[model samples]
Target: MATDLRVSLTDRCNLRCTYCMPEAGLQWLAKPDLLTDDEVVRLVRIAVTQLGVTEVRFTGGEPLLRPGLPGVLERCAALRPRPRISLTTNGIGLHRTAKTLRTAGLDRVNVSLDTLRPEVFRTLTRRDRHRDVLEGLAAAHAAGLTPVKVNTVLMPGLNADEAPELLAWALDLGYQLRFIEQMPLDAQHGWRREELVTAEDILRRLGERFTLTPEGSARRGSAPAERWLVDGGPGTVGVIASVTRPFCRACDRTRLTADGQVRNCLFAREETDLRTALRSGEPDEALADLWRAAMWGKKASPDLDAPAFVQPDRPMSAIGG
Candidate 1:
C-alpha cells in the first residue's frame, strides 16, 4: 500500500512507434547519462529498504533493449519486502527471452498490442512485428507469468474499430486486456485532442455484443484501469479512462527515469535527479534524501483533470508509462 517503484532499464527501443517517438529519428541518451545495471539494482534495493516500497516494475522505451535484464531482475527479486516485480515491453525482444526472464524472477508482463490486423499493427506501431508480439504473449503465458496483460492504447480513428475484436481475442487467449484512453503524453505530439474517445463509448459498444459485470478489484495504488469481467471470457478486461474519469485522487506510484531522476507526476514540469547522489559514494544518507524528496513530492496526481488538459514536456517513452 506504500509507494511503488518504477525503474526504467533503458531509453532505447526497437520500434519507432509514432505515438512515442518521431519517425525522423531518435537521439539516444548518452550511456553515461543512464543508470548502469548495478546502479539500477542498487537503487531498487535502497527503495525497498528505505522507502517502504512493496512493488517494483521495470519499464522503458523498451526495457528488454537493456543488456543483462535478467540479471537486474534477479537482484530486484531479492528485496526483503519481496516486491511484485513486473515488466512492460512492446515484446519485440521477448520472443525467445521471455522464459529466461521468468526464470530470472519476473512476476508478470504487460505487452502493448494495439491492433490485431497485420497492416494496421505495422501502421500504428511503425513496425511489422505483430507476429512477434503474439509469440511473446504465448511465451509469457508458458512461463507462468500470472494474468498476462495486453495494454491497448485506444485511438479513435485508428484502432477503435478493432476494440471488440481485440477484446474477444484476449478473452479467447485468457489474457487480461486493458484499453487505455489516449492522453497527451507523446514527446512528438501530433495527437489530435478532438480524437478523444471516452471509456463509456468503448464499453457501451462492447456491452451491446456481450455482457459485462463490474468485478471488485484493488482500488488502491495507482488504479489505472477500472476493473470489470466479461460474462463468458476466460479472463477479465480493464478500461483506463484517465481522460474521462481521472483516478488521480488515488495515485500512489512515483516514476524513476533511467537517468535516476524521480518524477513525482509524469505530467509535472519538474523532476529531481538522483543519479548524482547515488554516485556520490554517500550511499546511505544520500539515498534517504532522494527517497524523502520523492515521497513528499508524491501527489494524488497532476491537475490535468479535463479533456482540455495539455501535457507538459515529458515524452511517454521517457516517462515509462
Candidate 2:
C-alpha cells in the first residue's frame, strides 16, 4: 500500500537549476488550474483517512513560493492520525518562512544545495542566491527543524569533486547530507548515464576522507537513500542512487501534481487526472478509490535502464521532485 504522498503545491520556481530547468521563458501552469488550498487539504484528508497515508511531503518548483503554504500545513496537521509533514524546497525564500512553517506544524525539510561556491552555485542554478540558501539553512535550524537534509545532485565534471566539502559543510551545521544520482527528469530531457556520478564513486571519494560504514537494516528500509554512518558516529550521510541502484521494489510513495494529476512513479508516462473527478462532484470515498486503483496498477518498477526508456512529459519541477 502507498503510505507516503508527495503533493506539488505549485509549479512555479525562482531558480533555473541546470539539472532541472536551465532555460528561461518557460510557460507555467495557469493559476486557476492549480488546486486551491481546500482542494489540497481534502485530498490529504482522503489519503490519510481512507488510503492509509502516514506521510505527506509538500514539494514544488519551490514550495515556499505558495502564499497559503502555512495554512495548508495547518490543515494537513489537523487530520486524524495526523500525517508527518515535510517539505522539499530550494531554500531561496526559506529564511523568511521556515519558522512560520515550523509553527504551522511542518515536521522537517529537505533543501537542495548543490555547491557551496557562489560562482558554481550561480552556474548550476542560474541564480546567485547562495547566501539566501545559507541563511535559510540557519533559519531552519534555529526554528528547531531537526534533521534538516541537504540534497546534492551529483553531476560529472561539475559538483562531484565537492563531495567532501559539501559533507563537511553539512556536518558542521549539524545537518544530514544526501547525494542523489542525476535522473532523467530534467526539463531539457538531455539526461545521459555517462554524465552521472554514481553512488559507488561518491562512497569511494567520501570514504577516503571519513571512516564510513553501511547503515544497519533498521535505517535501510524503503527509503531511496542508502544511508551510511560517518566515522561510525552520530551523524549520517545518504546516497539516493536512483540510476546506479534503483529502489523501486520498496517504493511506497505516490505523487499528486499541483495541477491535480496522480502519478504512481517519478518516471511514469501515464497519469490519472483527479481534478476532473474532484471538480465533477466526486465524493471523498470515490476520489480515494481512484487513488487506490491508480497505485494498485503502478508498474512493479520503472525501467530506467531499458533501451527505450523515455523521459516523462513533465519535468522535475512539474512532477514535484
Highest TM-score: give the candidate number.
2
Give per-residue CA lDDT, model 1, range 1-321, as digits (tens).
246778887778888776778875667778899999988888888778887788888999899988889999998887787788999999886878988998899999999998888898888878789999999999999888867999988776788877788888998888989988877787677666577777988898778777888766553346678877688543677998887788777677778898888887767777887888888886666887866876686644554446656677778787787
Best by lDDT: 2
Candidate 2 Cα misplacement greater than 4 A, ranges: none
lDDT of 1: 0.81
Taking every candidate in turn, the Cα RMSD to the unseen true structure, in Å, is: 1.9, 0.9
Task: Show model 1 residue runs off by greater than 4 Å.
Answer: 217-222, 232-234, 305-310
Instruction: Report the lDDT tens digits of candidate 2 across residue range 138-178.
Output: 99999988789999987777788999989988898899999
The lDDT for every candidate, in the order shown, is 0.81, 0.91
TM for candidate 1 is: 0.94
* Model 2 vs. true fold: TM: 0.98
